[model samples]
Target: MKILITGGAGFLGLHLAKYFSEHFVGNKDFCSLLDIAEFDKKEYPKNCHFIKADIRNSTLMYQYIKSMDYVIHAAAALPLWKEKDIFDINVGGTKNILEASFKNKVKRVIYVSSTAVYGVPKKHPIYENDRRVGVGSYGQSKIEAENLCFSYIKKGLNVTIIRPKTFLGTHRLGVFEILFDWIHDGKKIPVVGSGNNRYQLLDVDDLVEAIYLFVVRSGHPQGVQRQQGHPKGDLIYNGAFNIGAEKFTTVKKDLEKVFIYASSERSESRSHNKNSSRQARTISKVFPTPAFFVKKALWLFEKLKLSPLYQWVYDTADKDSFVSVKRLTETLN
Candidate 1:
């Protein structure tokens, strides 16, 4: 099977490329990586082929996707960018990919959507059908992209949409990088408010596994098509599935673990469950930052065009942003 991954040089795209190259090793199993940015060849497996091109290029997208069995559409203009730039890549690029996939008859395309479509979620365990009131243009663009996927689906294109939460692990940067830096410098980690809000995060490994499941099980015998009386059985997963960890922990507890393990090499072993008692002790040292002041600072940062993660922290600082994965689990089974 020939698989093409858009945004292949990116964090999640690179991870998926590496996974497919290492695990899907049949001679016929070829992997193609597409991205506008150039990547270090040594970082990827020899089986993975790289193609540098913008997803907005319909001709190029069609050229590469024509012979591919599957596509993982992970390209997007992340938050905190110019509004026009966000929409162009997030929405326009998606349109190009969907159009090319449809024209080329790709078997199935996994659209890597985002949980940001929920936008400052007001409810816990946010469901797939929940209203999407995107916080910013980036989130709104994601919703637009998903709508585009549905449009293509109506034309008989097989697509599965996976809305993932803020995922971490290899190639993580931005706010997460700040956490690691603070830990290395022995600086106090900032916590907005009591840091008790429950925020869910997905590990990149888990996310890769979820996408792999869709790739391996392109057919479904368990559930009916979302569209009424549709002839195709499991060719597509209509709508979207919220992807996150099954279990959730409060922000403070998560930070405690980060601090404990990241502070020193010796403390790494203590992060395991075997040292739960010791972890409990470290939790007490968690610092607190008043949400009121943080909000004010965020406002200034926005005006000054500062880091994007600050706005993210301000929005989710005192809220529960976890999601339900019940539908995903059932689909995987």
Candidate 2:
């Protein structure tokens, strides 16, 4: 089938493009991507096509989408940004996708929505059936995008919505990139208070598997019709999965481990102060490191009007954040 992925230069988009190119070889149907970035032809798949364009360009995107069999809409704004950018793109752009798909008569359009669509998880296992409410503009925008899908479904667009948790693996690398980069850079990892907050993160590979299932399922090609008793040609999924070393991790304790692992590679920790078990003992688990703590402390200092220490702390803590991923198992499966 001819497939097109939007925001194809982003991490998840790149992975999806690779997956489709390598796995779908029948008739060697086009596996193309649309985004504003240029593809490195020398390094990227030769057979796969890449079209540079903004998702909001309705006229261009609408005309371009006409020849495809399916679309994987992975474009959107994260919850960490200003609200207006989020609305202008995710909401408006989604409406445009639906319009283009409808006009072109594309087979299936898989929307890679976010757990942000649900704001914070109220229940341990948030199912596809749970209510969607958001805290900030990020979540609010996601909610709007999801509603857009349903709106298209009402108009007879074949749509499927997947709400994913803190998924990681490639380009985007989750939020954990900060921690990894910190440890690698010989900096102390910061931890929040005791670092006990947990979050569910899914592997992008596993998420790709789920997307494959929903998209290829038997359904109408032209999307769900309007005035429906129930959405006739759509699938909704809560994308939660546990792919971390453990289901949960603490900040302070985890950061300590990472720091020990990173610093102990020096062979000097053996001679340095070894009296305090927490101080000298090498951490064995995957989590945040001392730099994570240092980061939080710095953030605190900045908030409290502290001096030089605040700047140092901010530098180290720039990447010190964590989330629990245990709840993912219940939601995705």
Candidate 3:
């Protein structure tokens, strides 16, 4: 079984490649990684093929997707990218991938979408059927790309849309990197508001597992079975589902845990050194700020290209932003 992973050099792409490589150990089963950026050959498994090609190039996408058993559409322009680029890459690029996969008759296409499609909702534990109101260009692009997925599904393309929350794991940079740097330097970490909001996060490993379940268990051409209540031809996994960490606490508590862990590690290292003083090192602390002012400042910084924080991030930082994984769990079970 051959697999194609788009955005193969990205954070999630790298994780997915590692996970799939471990499972697909058969002589014939291998992964083809497609990305615009060059891949570090050392980071990927030997059973993988790397192709540096932009997904926006429809011809390249078409040629690359041919004869693939599965296609993981993980490529997209992130929030920090320009608005035009985000739409072009996220929405338009997705159309290209879907078209190629559809034409090639790939068995399944797993689309790595985002919870950002829900935007900053007042409702807690958002469900799959909840209304989607995108917050920014990135969020809006996801919504548009998801619509494309649904359209293709209607045309008999087996697609699974996985809407995961902000996930983190090894080598995860972006906003989390800034937080880690502040914690490392013992600088005060600022929270947009009272750090009491229950902002859930997912481990990338868990997300990869969830995606694998969809790939192997559903939308197969041969063993295609419908759920009890679903439509006649609709397979269980060929739909959108929300996924996130089952266990999480308030933002303040989580950040504090990281700080505590970092402090302990530093203290342990100091204790081992005979020449080092026993004096305690300064530890990082969470500093809460007024959300209104912080949002205004962030907006200004974004306009001036001074900060990486985007509207969707700061707008929902202090809000209750978790989705119901009931659909995902129940369906998988």
Which prediction has the highest TM-score against the true structure? 3
Alpha carbon deviation, residue 221, candidate 1 (Å): 12
- Per-residue lDDT tens digits for candidate 2, residues 75-173, read 886544456878888898988888999889887788887755554444544555567676556667778888878877777777777666556686555
TM-score of 3: 0.93
TM-score against native, each model: 0.88, 0.69, 0.93
**lDDT per residue (tens digit) for residues 67-131 in model 3:** 78889999999898989999999999999999999999988899999999998899889998898
Alpha carbon lDDT of each predicted model: 0.80, 0.63, 0.87
Q: Sort by TM-score, best first.
A: 3, 1, 2
> Candidate 1 residues 282-302, lDDT tens each?
322567888888888887888
Native-referenced Cα lDDT, model 1: 0.80
Q: Which portions of model 2 show Cα errors greater than 4 Å?
A: 26-29, 80-82, 171-175, 185-188, 219-333
| Preferred candidate (lDDT higher): 2 or 3 | 3
* Of candidates 2 and 1, the better by TM-score: 1
How does model 3 fare in lDDT? Answer: 0.87
- TM-score of candidate 1 to 2 decimals: 0.88
